[model samples]
Target: MEWNISGQDFVTFSRFVGAALAMGLAAIGSAMGIGLAATGALKSMVRQPERQGEFVRTMFISQAVAESTAIYGLVVAMLLLFTTGGGHTDGIHGSDWVNGLRFLAAGLTMGLGAIGAGYGIGIAGTHAIEAITQRPEMSGVFMRTMFLGMAITESPAIYALVISMILIFVMGAPDAVGVFSGNIMDIARYVGAGLAMGAGAIGAAIGIGTAAAKALVAIARQPAKQGPLVRTMFLSMAITESPAIYALVVSSILIFVFTPTDAEAARIFGGMDLVAIGKYMGGAIAIGFGTIGAGIGLGIAGGGALDGISRNPRKESSLVRTMFLSMAITESPAIYALVISLILLFVFAVPDTMSWAQGWAELAKLLGGGIAIGLGTIGAGAGVGIAGLGGLIGISRRPQKEGAMLRTMFIGMGVTESPTIYALVVSLILLFVASSDVSTMSQGLHDFARFLGAGFAMGAGAIGPGLGIGLATRDALTSMAKQPAHEGALVRTMFLGMAVTESTAIYALVVSLILLFAVG
Candidate 1:
């Protein structure tokens, strides 16, 4: 153990690990995307046995586009393997751990970023094939839509790639340049940035693809309305992209703004500024995990609007109005996440004086609040989408009662959002009220547990009821559409069901409050 740094080429070893992660994770999404393309194309060929060649051609094209993200990852892996950009040229030393983690973060960023984009492109291809099968004459329009959707879906992956390349070619830690470089805090920020970009890409890409897929179907159903449909699709996808944008913003802030200068790293060795660590880490987690559900929800709502438009083209204006409303509400959870992230990043500062244990307590508090809002909103966002889509479908069928149907939709979404609201409350308490100045290690640890326990207790608690309430209200809206004469009965019954479904979120809030206020 006391031997010199001659035991292992740690730098090379770390690069190899990074290479493995980049290619290995990228392979999964690309393979699945390719498989999805093949699956859909094959099914379409079977249905229209004579058009196999055309289907195969489009399938290959889609597969090719989907493969690009993996290709990007491959290039990153190769660079890491050969140490192409730059690295410790001297024989690998033990102090290369910071550089090692930086490269690891790079791989993770590219690998995770490719997943949703690849799969989403494949989804677009699948639906594109279906559109071709249904309306062979307008294959060109469908292809265009498919490609456009795929391109937009790839945006998040592109962001990830940029960050990955930056990590490889520009930034470093072992050969410390920034104040924060080569420190624990720098490592946390780098890793958090990776996660923020990578995971944030998932829901947004899928949502955009969902919209594209449905728009293709709508075009096939109503070619005369293609112009309107395409416009709606563009608007929907634009909004859906914001979640990834929020993640990107957080990633950029972490990488570019809050770095440690070389002087700072030299002066302070292992001074655990837990607040700064929490700021980067917690903010990343908030935007990264929080945007996922909202993006999916927005996509679902958008897709439903396309479906409704195709079904009742005569009511396009009304349906589009409803679509806008639905999307706005569905996107709120991501907004909440962005707000929390901004607050964490800009509002909190490392205290001037504190015990080391007190720092840990602060770290836990920030993380808990971030986790609370991040995970809590997922189910609520998706649930609201479910309800919104159901209401849209119902309105398409019964436009005469649009007013009543929309009222129900509003109530449903309002209730669906309660869980997120509850989580927000807990997060605020942690941010503003939770104690982090305890001098004793025991009290500090206690505060840490209390903060995290409340964060998790409420965040995880609100998820199920949010989705459950949304589903129940969806059916209620549909049922009302079917039997408008019995609207009274349906509305009352839906209220009761949703209230019961919401009880679980209430229980979670109670537990969170108890953790925050009653825990020793």
Candidate 2:
């Protein structure tokens, strides 16, 4: 008997082939676009070295726009394969092949559009840089305009992606078949996703490189404002990084969630559905981005605060409060990410259950853990804010007496950080330990218990004493500030206090270790 593909099978195969073509073709166009744009910008900058700032700002925005082409191609291909009924082999229709080809046409449209947008953005960046070199005074204004232009340039790519996704997912797939095509296809999908993330990496490297070069030039010109300029550069670069991270998150979701797996592999992926992976990855990225933002915010806040203190040293308390508020706001994103991570790892990661009772039981444990940690971070955030504010105030009032006040404030902050640490510990236990079926009394448990407790004991135990010494230093500074003539006496008292506090945290570490490793 002769073997021939059914109408449905042919359509499904065609859709897959189209997606591969769309991605491959778009990749070539994007590569050429990027090279052209970058080269033009470099030439412009070289010609007008004095207009470097304007040129760099323009170039950065241009490059961002150029990168959107690859993003477009990616979005189009995903939609074609996953969304469209053209990929459905269960249906019986002679029109399946035509529908599949139509889907392919949609991909082609988007792919070509991406190429044009990429080239346009690149050219825009090149010219903008050249313009800036000639008019250095208008650098800031030019930078703003450049970004606006780049954003507008990206609109077409976004539209193309939206259209392609609709064609594939909404119009094409109406009951896709052949999910059990061995593991080869799944592995290919995973590899493809991994490769896509390289585009994001490339964008990040270019952005960072450009930002760093400009920053060094700025610092060389204005050493006095070097700190603030560096902070600005870092912040801008981080914002640039957001898109790359988004790409990575999308790639990971595709690889980990969609791929077919054996019973063993299923044991890992099946623990949480596709939605859960998105949540976890999203949360992690949020945290990573927030951390970077916080660093920049803190630096800027500190610089401004120091300047304020210099002008009016007596109002130290008020200055500190402002600084604390800024820092707290800066850290909010990180805290949000932490809460989301806890929810995903604990609440979302659960075994499938046919019965309602089992499902509810799993949910209850997960939700309870999530709520507990979420609340803890809120408290931690508030405490740290207050402590930092108090420290800023104290430091501003007596610049010469900063050493002592800073010590005190740091201790207060340490105390504030403790609750958050506790919450983290609880979340980790819930995620890794409680979710697993391993019993506390098992041999595996014996190893885990010791391993965990010993690590915790050594770390947390050390923290307590370090905090105490920090407090002592603050007290000594305050005392010395009040009576400079009696500094010798204060120093003697401070050392004794510090030693006592340091000893306690150390003891806790020892006890924790003994409970973990020695007991086992």
Candidate 3:
């Protein structure tokens, strides 16, 4: 017996998988969020049996908000599966496979997008319940702050939803797959747009949620400082969401700009132009994964600032200033990531077609540059926050030792920032310095592995040192605050620890350098 398969069948099959992804990932986050809210409500009720009503009410509200993202996912899933699932013609036209990829990207965009927002909202809700338990009088304030944070946290997911909607309804809609899906480039655009917005939202949502949680507790501890704390919370959240905005901007460009016109599509039809694919998708990946660490770090620093101000209201100016500096350092990684993404999107040039060897090498180069910046920043971003938090903790405890502590903090932050700088350097070299114009298949594959390995080596290797140096700095600052007389000793110890901790990043740099220049 003989069997036959067609591209439209693949399209139909992809729709099923897309629906599953849309519903499945969406459910996981919302369920986790609901459980988190319930756990907090239960604990708060146990602490204050009489206030169960308020706790339950707040928990329910939080759960409801968290479910909204899942609902968006479900709506898209339903549409993908039911609205355009059947009764297709039998011909394999220009780009039915492109629609299949679009469906998958749309599903992923909505599904992964909701996770951070749902989880962040749950954290805010948990903090709200705890705040109420601590200060029953501040229930209203806690609830309001929680809601505000949850609202802001939803921004990333919303950007993702918009991208998903466009993927489904506009550019590569399943129903209009005949002419609209003319270009093979849509495959790159769809996947990149989905990834850019989807992964981008996670850290921002979580960061905003963290700020909200800290704000609620800060307000509860010092009810009179609610106004200023709330203001700080808003300011911090705004900054926290900026990384996601960068990703969203990149996604918008990928989806809207790279689309090939009908004539151009006719020229490039069914052609997997490797350079364009790599350039667009790599740009998306760079911004998408890169922003996560920055978002989380910003949240940590913001939370520290809120807590510090609550502890010593008179030193509000000092704490806020420190927060600005910490966040600025933390944001460096994301900036580097954004630069790589922009370069991939706008700066890199490619011809319409290439030799097989040439195409694959360029693909690897662009993708490697994206990976270098995106994965490399995670540790640097989060570590910066941890280190910054230590300084904030020290200053709040010993405000009189501001100048000494500030000096120590600055030194620590500078060291903490080194790994990200290394990643940035590695990414730049891959983008501009490395050679990829191979003439043979063996050479192309060699260069491909060379570039990709360098990226992974530097990116994965940088994470540990970024985190370690930050932890060391944080502990040193904390110790000095506890024992101001040991300031000199602590400062010396911190530098020593940082030097040792920095070795791993140096090793990554060495490996990356070898990969770029040593082989072939």
Candidate 1, 1-520: lDDT as tens digits: 6534421356566678888888888877788888999999999988999999999999999999889979978988998887743434444432365567778888888888888888888888889999999999999888888889889988888888998888877776645433332376677788888888888888888888888888999999999999999999999899888889999989989889877655546644332567667778888888988988888888889998999999899999999899899889998988998999999989987554456787878888999989999889888888898899998999999999999999999999999999999999999998988765687888888888888889988889888988898898899999998999999999899999988988999999998888888876
- lDDT of model 1, residue 470: 88
Q: Per-candidate TM vs. native?
A: 0.92, 0.36, 0.94
lDDT of 2 by residue, 86-190 (tens): 333445442454355546655654564454346545544654465455556656644554454445444434544544454454332223232222222232223
**Best TM-score among the predictions, by candidate number:** 3
TM-score of 3: 0.94
lDDT string for model 3 (5-65, tens) is 5666878888888888888887777778888989999998888899889889989999999
Q: What is the Å distance of residue 209 in model 1 from its true position?
A: 0.4
Off by over 4 Å in 3: 1-3, 85-94, 173-182, 261-263, 268-272
Predict model 3's lDDT versus the native: 0.84
Evaluated at residue 40, the lDDT of candidate 1 is: 92
After superposing all C-alphas onto the true structure, candidate 3 shows an RMSD in angstroms of: 2.4
- Output the lDDT of residue 445, model 2: 42
lDDT (0 to 1) per candidate: 0.84, 0.46, 0.84
